[model samples]
Target chain A: MENRKIPDNKIKIPIIPVFDPIEELNMYTSLGSLHTFIKGSKIISPGIPFYSIIYLISGQLEASIVSRTGEEKYLFEICKNCIGVAINPNDDHEFQITAVKDCIVYFFTLDMMVEILSQDANLLKKFILNIVQKVHYFEHQARDLYQCRSSSRVFSFLYDLCLTKGKRVNDHYELAVENISQKMIAKITGTHPVTVCKLFTYLSREGIIKKNKKVIKIYDLNKLCNLIADEELTY
Target chain B: MENRKIPDNKIKIPIIPVFDPIEELNMYTSLGSLHTFIKGSKIISPGIPFYSIIYLISGQLEASIVSRTGEEKYLFEICKNCIGVAINPNDDHEFQITAVKDCIVYFFTLDMMVEILSQDANLLKKFILNIVQKVHYFEHQARDLYQCRSSSRVFSFLYDLCLTKGKRVNDHYELAVENISQKMIAKITGTHPVTVCKLFTYLSREGIIKKNKKVIKIYDLNKLCNLIADEELTY
Candidate 1:
């Protein structure tokens, strides 16, 4: 994998980046603090002040998002010599990195990485290439990988959402107030995300759910309960 | 959506790039040549010496990879003001972009874009951000979109590959000499890509297909033929 010929992203199916790991290793070690986490420990989770460049030094890690209801959806794995790319940890929901095995992690501040990158144009280019490769890899996952969840199961998933947690409008009846997302539902319910998109469209047509940039409003809690009980929803 | 303050990729997505389209339009018009293609025309395809930055000024385009056997798998769509990102188009296989509607395209050479970017670092930064968003989008597609094709269907897909095209040894039966990919098969057959991956493992264990970086050897022609005929071959 160590090709000195300026390893490019290959811009295609070889999802893994092919830059010189040795050079990357050198760069990571140049200026970063090392932190060790034991197995089954939270490495980086929600509400933690983690603002740095994350590079795995040893052992294994897994990253995922935990819904407000505490349902965890798998994201990706990190092992030795891998970059743990967190897009924005401070999202509305929760994101976590867990140690699957005893691990050593290297954390570099953004300024330090910028300093290093600014110093070496080639390295900056390489870094850009690797990030492109990674971003490309994850985007594919979002597009596909959705399972076709039965409509009832989807309704049930909607009903059971406990985190934002899932809220109740009156007399213990449920209504979602927060902007719950389609991808999360897809991951959690194993339903084709198209279904979630369709659900939104259907809601618009039926005027069942009203959602916007910041808020979501669900109508007819009894109707949602009825669908769950019937367990045979078509759309 | 025209949200400035330097539109970010949103770290997680809502994948369509959100940079100010007006500013982007100005940049494209500044350095690009306007080329118009009538509807149902091939905008960009394999075997064309297209080494330039591509921006869609207007109209619609579809990008896909055509297998050697003449089978086309849909990749993504490009509408107005979209960046048609081609990673490394000079792969061993074919990639094409076709105009679904009448299109006006802006073609910018790398030097021109670089020159413009060199003038303003903000534009350069914005460009990088947009690229990261795009690369991230495609990667998700590769990961999760594969449907599960049955073993028989998978085998049939393997058998029917006509492009590299699929070659028949001894003028009677076929074996893939070139490295046929699982993603292409998944896209073609709607088979879960994991099944394709499993097929590779099964082949290695049975010593049926031997593959390396440069060479792939397939043994036993009649066995493959019989399996396809019976249509109940279980892996």
Candidate 2:
């Protein structure tokens, strides 16, 4: 391989403000194309020669992978201005992406993406931040899903929510839970609704977590983390 | 937030050949400082207000995080020319990096690293590939670790190896396993070495995996994947 002659770019890297993927998409319009999908259409599936990255400009997408038993394992959702899928051609893992609502998407071939990103520092920074954030998210999900105990799994999920979404308030973490509920938590963790309620009480009585009208607070993160290893916790 | 003005660098993006991190590190010498740590010294520790990305230029380091019970969970090792730690200032998680051998390392404040990377498309691409590869590895690990059965955990480990290192033949995946052993498999999966050997025989008899003197072959990836959900397989 020939030596890569990199010229020194003396420009100061500016503080990146809020990200706007749509704005970035406009710059490379000549190199890529925009496509639309109606609701209930498959956007991406396994073994389809996928190597490009598609960014959602509008609507929503549900990305999943079929497990060995042929069950769809929900990976994530792609909302407006977010990445729909980024696949390396050499990777062995396969996933399916479907449109949950009518969507407008932009496709950038991997080569073109690399070209544009390598040329523009700000664009590369936004892309890196986006992927790094996803890495952080999957890390948290893996930790929670790896819990052996069922009830502890739910607690791990809450702990993840606190670490990712809750803010440190004085001595502990506090999160406004106005948008999340027990039923939603159950659906995610596969625990029964009754069991999720019981485990919440268990954590509340144990001083690990406190639940109020529209907020959930963590008094001891370490204690909640420890409960993730327990076989079971009785309320 | 204002719209970013991106210039047209008519220079075609060159094909990225083999990565040379040391070459990349040399270009950014002014942006970072190099330091040496003797064996047994801690490079990163929890609660030390860490926010930098260190590149290992020499020797080895072990990275770990203390679980809630104060036991160390081994994360990964840092060899030469690899990132020892990349901590974002806003992230709440903490980890400890320790020198297993006397090491020379380069420190780049997260800001400086980002600055340098954004300025060089080639450097940024390498960094993205590195992090994305880590994401792939951890996802494989999470899948294997999520398997509840002990024997199946070992199978999951093999399945991971197959997916990562094995090459596809006519219909099966074949891996040269001269380096891995039953003892290593048992240590990783927390199963007995005897159990590991027995499980190998069970999988072989079941027509899922075939182990030879220096190689392991998988006839059916789906069958092996399905076995990860099993309660147990007796040889």
Candidate 3:
């Protein structure tokens, strides 16, 4: 997982929180705080105050928030070209995050955000723009799980990950499997691990992709996208 | 639905894109362009550039993105208090959005956002924060769908909604269901609308709550929370 390089044909999904480095350098250079959480570390728990938004440069992380009744916990999935938000860093908020492997996240606090937004409505507007896109993304995921078949969902998800964070190599597409797991994918895709395992096995067998544990190397990007598109199969 | 007053309990559900009035005033005082769409209007289509983040103060909206392939479309359910990202405003990305009712949305262009973020890192940070919380909320939903029982998921969803967005009256918590439909509840809970109907009927018959179309009045908030907490027999 750690050695996997982003594959070729991997579409670039750039959230680009700060698309312009010069602007970023001017505003957040002083306000931001940099903190590093090594692998196997718990960054925040339910009892602690909410922390800042941490940007992941490299490594993996996992976090869960318990249900309101505190009876069960829910985990976060999806990474690379993604940003993690823990809003209410005060009491009565639900947030629990842990590093899966050695990961680096930049914590951007609320106070600094307020200060920036206070001066620039354009900044606030940009911030709102990102939120709007994210809501749309999740809503789409929810719809796919119900309306599409499991195989459709799987291929769609893979294609999406490639688009979001994939990099183009010589011919193959290498997905950044930073902290993603089969179990997490199963949960998100509404399939059992065994089912996902079987599906993965099929993809590998068809020479569409190869998996070295968590990292998947796509040998045939066209085939994968085609499967996601399901040109031959009618939904 | 227009007459529905904001309930105190319902306010507990933080609108991830909400801007504090004072803070907002400190930033943007002038209202930007107000884009209007008739009922059943298509706001966005695939391959369209994502140029703005839209905030809906009133009216209903829907958005969907094709999963890489052009064959399938994923629809987004939206209402007031929703802020959406036009992720690829400059690229030939295709995602379609429609208005369910005559709607008015506030649009902040991508150029403006980039300009702001470049000038201020805090602006970028705030945007990241908004995405983080949103991702967290959806992650929680995904987790519940996978791990929790059907009944638990329904009850807990209702309970959490109440905690975040419901209004507390003398003895009951009032839920204003302007934007939430049985279909939406089903989609989020991963249940059928018929089941949600049955669950609601069962709860109303038991005198735990009273449903007036979209308005749900809970007679005992504590008990409702307990129902979710203890995983009591909900149906």
Candidate 4:
């Protein structure tokens, strides 16, 4: 929510490191391949056979999993400067990633990553820490989704979105990324589209948030924060 | 439940690599320390100011976190050859690890891990992969915990435990480690102690599993599997 003064450090933004300047430059020169995708393009399809690191240079990507029943579940968004690694070679490409906007991504095969690691130990260590931190964040997200109520889930999702991708504009916060739809919000919060719609209506009625098509503007940031705080106690 | 024939490759056992033969040898010689903890001893305490990788050499260790309400929640168990890395230097040590039995653990600091990576490129890659794999596993675990009911949670917990630390016996699968308690099971499954007790009673009455003090032997593994399958569809 953008209307209140939110502390910057409260948000946990994942960082991708360029550990060794010389080694990184050389690795990019030798092994990295740049790929561009148009908005709404599928970057990774299920059942494709490849394992590598996808470093988002610009734009946004959404990762989702399609279940056996053809139900799609949204995982998380990979914003610019973030790295997504596929560690298991045997994995069946269960995760499908699509470009949320026109994007440029750097691809590095597992072998190439290993080669880079060989040259830069600091890079390897940072890579390991990156995954560890991601695990921790996902664990918390899981806990919130499973343990908290639907309203709390929606609030927490918005809070996290603000933390990671929101920009301060005058007295309000605006999300840096665009085209966040109600369906996308529903998927990320693990709620039904109808439920998300209802919650937004309630928030709007209460003067907590205002929705304009795909854009959600928070008018009372502290109110949303207090809602989360109250939800935490009950859950 | 280990009585049924389980395909060997069906289990996903995480493997930690000893990266460089010479550097690994030098690492042990330079900084490796072996520590032994008796049963029930605290291997890691809350608020401790240190970060290291603990490699389980022998015996079992249980990692738990105390909630704000002072309830101890069992996270997971560490068995032999598994490496546990503490990546955050500023962490308040919210996780407390205790030995479930007399245990031998190898300790290496973050600095030493970086040193090891500096010497061995392959090890660094494996380390990064290890954490990535862990992130994936924890993500699944979080999904199960959040999406599944208490019974499915308990069943999945046992299923995962069997996969990771189970050993083949004559007719049944047995856990390699010992001293798994009901309270611990309740904590890990995110259910009430009474609920876990009730589930075990139901399983025992239905001739699916038999519980001895702390060890549980499943007589009909298929039944448990079926329960999971049924639960999955509903959840």
Candidate 5:
């Protein structure tokens, strides 16, 4: 593949293509449109009325949910084989801008996503399954945050990412947390920035992970799994 | 509404004529058939290849998530306006038979739900919004678990619940934890049963809450909210 010239407004975000699991384009032939977002772009403005589900091919996106009290941030980070279904039209929430990199996302409007799903049971099942899976992940994250202490929480997060997206090769599992910042992780972990830093430092010191500025390389899969299972807080 | 002598199985969960600020049937209209389960009934068998979401209207439900290592139990006790969306079909995690009260749930296959949402963009949006709201609640719970030390977590939970669902008349807000057991709350709070019991006893002695079996009737709204906002633990 040739290096495509980047769009003037956007930096090209890393996108991994799948040859085997390609979705049938003929499925939702009507109700959706393919949309690309430049880095630090706005897809939907707060207080505006729109409804769509977004599938991320490559890039990072954050949603700011505005409430009467204040604004809350929700990160719809990169996920393979998953799509987000935004169902409310008149419901307005706050969304602030913060983009790590440029990205491409497919937008399936409510009417179109619904029409396609209704017409095709298999596709509908797939969509529902995707939402369910995401919900499961969210639930698991919530549980981890609730049950585990700060030290073990980090291990649990890493272990979970590995389990979902890790690739095993030569006894090590390589994982990816694309466009995810340490501050974002701190919010997700429900801990202070210092706490997250200390946890990362401790893990790196133990040689369990090879930390390279942003990317994390796991050295031992078995040890990582062990750490996740051990709730005694070995670190 | 008159109390009609509907057969035990024939009885449908009572639908609220109107649900809060938003009054619409789009959320619950998809419920074609009503499923009534006696207390302790198993909605989904473990390892069974079934894809259905159970929307609870009344009573308590305990879903045990089974993994290769062990099982974890989650309590879903529904009051009015509280719905449960089970998303276990995403992976191999099966829901084991735990416990359920006289629960009335509307069970819909994945295809069915998608079909409904496809036809009605408004409904789909409502569904997504509903789920997002639930996610927000869980996230708040997780945050409380992380930031607060002990009894404060409990107060925060109560305070948030009141703010979301409480009925305010005059100055006091009527907060009800309906049809849920204290043990179930302990699970939600991630605390020991004895600790919850002790906290409840202290609160009752202090006249903060009037306790009935299977119910905790909060009497003072300001105090509860203040305790929740306070930097120090109240109990």
Candidate 6:
């Protein structure tokens, strides 16, 4: 792929911005307020005034959108160094963010961030790139959901989780999903709880995965990827 | 909604950026190049080097992503004042943009844009907000595709079109979806081509919409919105 020649006039931009958490903390400390929440605490909720860009300094969080009729759609999980934006300040917030574990978050007011960004063009570009990267990520995830079936959706979600947050231990990879319930997983995968339970049982029986408490261990990463591949082809 | 008071600490930001075509043209003129394409011409293609931010100055275009196996997925339609981003510089572009009508587009190199943005923070904020808006739009569209049936999806698409681009004529709204065929509509709605044809015929017969050549006139916008409402309830 590197050997291919691109046209000289065609310019390239970074799809996503890279941020060091420690550096981000030092930069924004003077302008923002730091807040800490214990596990299972709501960080932002619907109908609340939310205008700041919430930066996850450490720990994990889950963000979701709730419809007017109370149907909750799980959006995505936020790991460290991720930024979350609420599009409007006046409208009722259709989304909520909650800490899945004890977390350190920084609330940078939009005005202050704008004030600071007005002087630093490079930082602003990085900010824009971060948002663009998120847009691409959501677009891809939505496409997968629309095209793949229930089983494949579950498998794909697991495969992505392993790739992003998995820790390698010898030949296996382990992920601490931590407090994410079967129902939440079902919501994320667009599958039913029963279906998720069934799939897990099947995988366990096949010795492909072992779930002990909040952690899931994948014995063979290649096997799981192959399953997703087969599912995609079959669909 | 306006009666509600937000907390003092909460500072609002615009949900979407506002850009004037004339203003954008002037800004990019010295920094980038202007290009024009005839209807049906390809602006971006797969395996081609594409790196700059493409801004639509006038006219319309359709962008789609093609899989390695040649399966094409219609992504979105680009209208005036919209910005298109090619996410990665090194990877083969999975998407292509084609002119739906004779279009004037501006190409801004990433480096040039970065250099200019580094001097202006408000413009940078607007740029970031624009990408975030696109992200939210795609997310909503994907949700509709995932949750709604084929017929509902088609209706929802039409309803949204009328709301956004529809021009008022007498008591009705008309949308000039010129050059957009039933097949394209099917791709956008995630329905079969035959299904789109059947729905159009049914809608025409029911007097909700009147189709003459490539133009569609919505005689009863309320009825169309109601149809989508009913579909949601039934589903």
Model 4 earns a TM-score of 0.72
Residue-level lDDT tens digits of model 1 in A58-131: 88777765543464655566767776655443435266889979998888765566556555555555555566
Model 6 C-alpha lDDT per residue in residues A111-175, reported as the tens digit of each score: 67777666665565566666666666555555655566778777867887788878999878998
lDDT of 5 by residue, A1-235 (tens): 2343122111111112111121643454355676777887777666565566666666666544443345343434444334554433543434333344686667776545655655665565455444544444445555655556676666666776776777776757777666445666676655677887887787788888877655678887667667756656644
Give per-residue lDDT, candidate 1, residue B147: 25
- Output the chain A TM-score of model 3: 0.59
Better of 2 and 5 by DockQ: 5
Native interface contacts retained, candidate 5? 0.23
* i-RMSD per candidate, Å: 5.7, 8.5, 6.9, 5.3, 10.1, 5.0
Model 3 chain A: which ten-residue window has the lowest total lDDT? A16-25
Give lDDT tens digits, candidate 2, residues B154-180.
777788778778999998999887856
Displacement of residue B175 (Cα, Å) in model 5 is: 4.7
DockQ of each: 0.13, 0.15, 0.24, 0.31, 0.20, 0.34
Q: Considering summed lDDT, which 10 consecutive residues are worst modelled in model 6 chain B?
A: B12-21
Candidate 3 local lDDT, residue A78: 22
Give one digit per residue, the lDDT tens place, for model 3 in B33-103. 57888898878877755556666767877765565446444344566755565555445565677887999
lDDT of 4 by residue, A24-115 (tens): 33346347888899999987776664467888778888776655334566667777677777443444546678997999888887667777
Interface Cα RMSD for candidate 4? Answer: 5.3
CA lDDT, candidate 5, residue B232: 55
- Tens digits of per-residue lDDT for model 3, A1-235: 5343222111233322112111332345356676677877877777576655555556766656666556434344324433455555456656677787777656666555556555665545545544554454454555555456677777767776777767778888888675567776775566677877877887888898877865788888788777764635432
Best by TM-score: 6
What docking grade does candidate 2 earn?
A: incorrect
Query: What TM-score fits each model?
Result: 0.47, 0.66, 0.65, 0.72, 0.65, 0.75
Q: Residue B130, candidate 4: how far off, in angstroms?
A: 1.7
| Top candidate (DockQ) | 6
Residues B76-158, model 5: lDDT tens digits: 34444444455444234445643356876667655567666666655554565555444444444444456565576566556
How does the DockQ of candidate 6 come out? 0.34
